[model samples]
Target chain A: MTISFTDAKSLNHDQLEEGTAFAPRFDAHGLITVVTLEDGSNDVLMVAHMNAETLSLTLESGIAHYWSRSRKAIWKKGETSGEMQEVIELRTDCDQDCLVMVVRQTGRGAACHTGRKSCFYRKVIMTDGTASLEDTGLPRLFDPEAVYGG
Target chain B: MTISFTDAKSLNHDQLEEGTAFAPRFDAHGLITVVTLEDGSNDVLMVAHMNAETLSLTLESGIAHYWSRSRKAIWKKGETSGEMQEVIELRTDCDQDCLVMVVRQTGRGAACHTGRKSCFYRKVIMTDGTASLEDTGLPRLFDPEAVYGG
Candidate 1:
C-alpha cells in the first residue's frame, strides 16, 4: 500500500508533538519545500518543492521527486539529465512544513541543469557600494548543451 | 555605502547569465528563502527568510539575521536563545533568488527554538497504512521555557 499524510490543520499539539505520524503541512499552493543534500559529503545539492503526489512517489520509489511550480508538474529528478538522487534518509522539521532529504546522487552526480555539482555555484561580493556575484569556479561535470540540446 | 540589487524583471538572459551584478528576484512578498547549515557538520539547521534589510545586515555584520514573517520583525538569531550563528560563508543560487549560509553556531550550538541542536528533530514513518513522525531522539541542548521565559 502507498503511504499517506495526516492533515496538519486537524491535528492537536499532543498528537503532533508526540505521535509518530507523517503530517505534512502543505501551503495553499499544495506544495512543501524540500532541501536535498549529498549524503556522504553532506553538501547541499538543490532546493525544490513537492506536492503530495511527488512526496508519495519519492517515499515509494526511494528516489527524489519534486513539484515544478514553474512548469506546474511533477519532476522525477534525473529523468532527463540522468542525475537521480537515491534517498538515504528523509527528515521533517518541527511543524513538518519543510523536508530535508539525504541522498546518494547517481549518474553524473551533478544536480544542477547547468551540470554543476550544486545549483549554488556563486558567492556574493560587495565592492565599492555594489553587490555582485563571483563564481566559485566549480567545474561542470557534464555538458548541458550536449545533454539537453541548445 | 549600502549595497543594492538590480530589479530582476529588467534583466535578460545575457544580463542574468553573464553579468556579475546581483539581482535577487524576491517573490511578491518581498522575501527570499535562506537556508542555514552548520559549517563543519553541514547539517541543515533551519530554513528561514530574509527581507532586504536583514539580508544586508547579515552581509555587513557577518551574523546570521532573518525576517520573522509571523512576528513581522527583524530577528537576530540567538538574541533571545543565545544560539547566534556566525556566518562563515554566504552563497546564492544560480539565479540569485535563494541563499545558503554556512555558519558556526554559537552558545549551545542549538539552532531551534525547540531547544534542539537543529530544528529538524523528527522523521516520518509510514507503516500499515498509517503515517506519523518518529522523534530522531536528538537531545535537547537547552530548556526552551528557561531560555525564553515561561
Candidate 2:
C-alpha cells in the first residue's frame, strides 16, 4: 500500500506548519530536497532529492531511496556499494518542502559514493578575494576505485 | 569585489570532484541547494537555496544569505527577526552542487520563521500506510506575532 500525503493546498498556513497533517509541497518538478544526517554524531551525510514515489518507498521500506536527477530513476542508496542507510528518524520542515533524515549509515559508514564518511569533506576558503576549496583532512574510508571498479 | 566561481563546465569529473577548485554547479534556475546546521549541536536548522550572488554575499559577509523563492529576492536571514545566522564554517559536497553551512543562530536562537530553533520541528510517522506528522516538542524561542507582527 502506498502512503498518501495530505494536500498542502487544502490547508491554511498555520495548519500546514503547526498541524498533524503531512502535506509536502513538492517543487515544480515534483521533487523535495532531503538532507541526510548521521544518527549519533548529527553529521550531515549527503543532500539529495526525492520524488513522491521514492519518498513513499523510503517510508515503507525504512531504507533511503532518492531520485537521481541525472539518471531520472529511483536510486536505492548504498544498494550497489553495500552501504545502505537505515532510517532512524525522518523529519519535515515548517513548510514541508524539505526533509531531514537521521539514519544509521551501514557498511563502512561511508555516505559519499567517493568513499568519504560524509559528502562534505572540503571547506570553502577565501584567499585574496578568490574562493578555493580545501580538503578537511578527512581520509577516504574505502578506496572508491576498488569498490566501484571504475 | 564580487567573488567569481570557476566554471563547472571546464572541469572534468576527477577535477570537479577530487580537485581543490570551488566550482559550484548551479541549477538551471541559477541556484544551489544549501543545508544549514547549528555549529556545536550539529542540528540541521534549515534547508534553503542560494543563487550565485547570495552565495558570494554569504561567503564575503560571513552571514547567511539565501534566495527567497517566495519573495524573489535575497534574504539575509535574521535581518528582520533579529535571528541572524553567523556562519561558522562552510563546506561543499564532492560535486560542489550542494553546501553545508555551520552557523551560530543568533537572536533568541530561532532559525525558522515560526520562531523555532530549527525549521524542522516535527517528525514524520507512518501508521497503517497513512503518514502523519508529530511535533518534536521544540518550543518557540520567540513569539512570531510579536517578532514579525501579525
Candidate 3:
C-alpha cells in the first residue's frame, strides 16, 4: 500500500462543448502524450498540453503543437532546436479527455528543450522502501556543449 | 472533418472492494489505456491497457499485472518472461473510469510484446500522402529473435 491514489479533480471545473467552436479544455494537468512511432517501436518524445489553437495546428499541419503553460504560448516541437515531431496519427481515449499523438521524429534529438532524446529518459524505482530516479542512458542527444560552447 | 468529436466517457463497471470475490466487468470496449509511472524519470513509462483481472492483481500484488487483450486473459508481466513491472502508484481520473498504474520496469525487454523496448517505440510521419513510420531506434535494447526467439 505504498502507492497513494489521487484523482484529477481539477478536470471537474469544465465541461465538454460539442459544437463548431467547441474545443476541448483541460485543467492544469491535462496533456497530449506525443509518442514517436517508428517501425512499431514507440517512445514518448515529450508531453505537451493542448489549447484549441495547438490542437487545430496539429490537426492541420501534421506536426504536434502544444501550449506551453510556463511560456504562455504555443510551442511546435523542434521549433527553435530543429528537433521537430511530425505527427502521423492522433488518437484519443474513448472519453476524449486525453490525446495520444503518434509521430515520426524528424530530427536527431528529442523534442524537449533539454536536448535529451526523450523527456522520459529517466526511470523510477521504489527500493529501500522509497522511489528514486534511474537514468535510462538516453541523454541530451544533441551535444549542447559543442553547440553552445560550454 | 472525418472524425466525430465527443465528450469524455469512462467505463466504471468494475469496482475493487478488498478481497472482493467476483468477476470484473467493463463496458464494450473495455479499458484500453494504463498510465504507468516511470519511477526515477517521473515521466510516464508508457500507457497500456487491461481488462479486469490484470487490474485486480495489480492492486493485489503491488506488481504490475495486465490482461493481455491480445492473449485474452490475465497475464502477469515478467512473471514467466522476467520482464515484470513493479507498481509504485495508482491513480484515476475524476470519474474513476480509467486507471493509471505507475510502475518500475524489470528490463529484460519491453513491456510490450513487440520486439521493441516499449509499445510506444515508433514515430510516424506524413509523406507521399501517406503516414510513414519514423525509425527512432526503438529496438536498441532488444533483438526480437534474440529474446523471444523469432
Give the TM-score of each candidate: 0.95, 0.98, 0.46
Q: What ranking of all candidate models by TM-score puts the best one first?
A: 2, 1, 3
User: Which TM-score value belongs to model 1?
Assistant: 0.95
Query: How high is the lDDT of residue B56 in model 2?
Result: 97
- Between candidates 1 and 2, the one scoring higher on lDDT is 2
The window of 10 residues in a row where model 3 chain A has the poorest summed lDDT is A14-23
Query: Candidate 1: where is the Cα deviation over 4 Å?
Result: none
- Indicate the residue-level lDDT of B23 in model 1: 84
Give the Å shift of residue B41 in candidate 1: 1.4
lDDT of 3 by residue, B23-109 (tens): 222436665356665665543445656765566556556788776655776777766557788887654322223444557888764
Candidates ranked, most accurate by DockQ first: 2, 1, 3
**What is the total number of backbone clashes in candidate 3?**
25
True contacts kept of each: 0.76, 0.94, 0.01
TM-score of chain B of each: 0.93, 0.97, 0.68
lDDT score for residue A40 of model 2: 92
Q: After superposing candidate 3, which stretches have Cα over 4 Å from the reference?
A: A1-25, A28-39, A145-150, B1-34, B37-150
Provide the overall lDDT of each model, using Cα atoms, as 2-decimal numbers.
0.86, 0.94, 0.51
lDDT, candidate 1, at B53: 83
Better of 2 and 3 by DockQ: 2
Best by TM-score: 2
State the weakest 10-residue window (summed lDDT) of model 3 chain B: B1-10
Error of 2 at A1 (Å): 1.6
